[model samples]
Target: MSRPQQVLASYRSLLRATRIAFDGDHRVFMAARQQVRQGYETGRTELTSEPEHYDEIDKRLEHASGVALLLRSNIVQGQLMHRKANEEPLSTGDHGIASQSDESVYKLRIHKHTELGDNDAVKGGKTSLAGTAKKIKWSNIDE
Candidate 1:
């Protein structure tokens, strides 16, 4: 529309973008707001005189809005990652939430011979690791 309106819209958009870019950091937003306002005031006369530059001004405002949107997306992604990291320790059986489905099947002999009777030499309980090893007299073999 009019040059004055266009200039005001751009100025306002710049302030809004600056506020978003800093997220909730008020100190930085205020500093950026002041600088943008001063810059807009100083350039007001020049913008009004150059009617042909309206298209270029619109493009620049559009670009600034896009950049702010991207910054907000980036901030959201970072927050998601932080939240995921915090949630991990509570899941995957780390914080005493062990998954019963993962019960180890390491007792192979017991599992394979679950039906064995008392007469069998295999035994009635789970096999120990040391029991799997047999000791032989190497001296007799050497003799």
Candidate 2:
């Protein structure tokens, strides 16, 4: 391939990755907003003074907080990958799309888990933060 083609491919990959990252960020923002709304509605005294409602609101806030953190991390990682791909020279046959795919996968995984946690929160169930924290601590043990 020609130099122009390589540059164009890299640019295209970067644009695609940016789009996916933005979409993920938008979803996270929307989810957090929705959780806030739900929390406000459920926690209000106008609604019956049900303990379950308060618990649900708390869970929603917790789940939203977790998802927001994950999304922020994913966005930073995506930007780093994008910068690395753009600044570094690519060898022949090194399609820039691979980095985009990795970022997209990371975003998608976060989205999936966020949705799952949101659903569980709606049902007044616990989220995976406990497990996630354990994994994080375990991974950090050597550091």
By lDDT, the best candidate is 1
- The candidate that wins on TM-score is 1
Residue pairs of candidate 1 with colliding backbone atoms: none
Model 2, backbone clash pairs (residues 3+ apart or across chains), number? 0
lDDT of 1 by residue, 1-143 (tens): 76567667766777666655554457876887888777666565555546687776676567656654544323320111123332433232211112222322111111111122332334745453334433433332211
Cα error of candidate 2 at position 91, Å: 9.4
> How high a TM-score does candidate 2 get?
0.26
RMSD of 1: 27.8
RMSD of each: 27.8, 18.8
- lDDT (Cα atoms) of all candidates against the true structure: 0.46, 0.39
TM-score for every candidate vs. truth? Answer: 0.38, 0.26
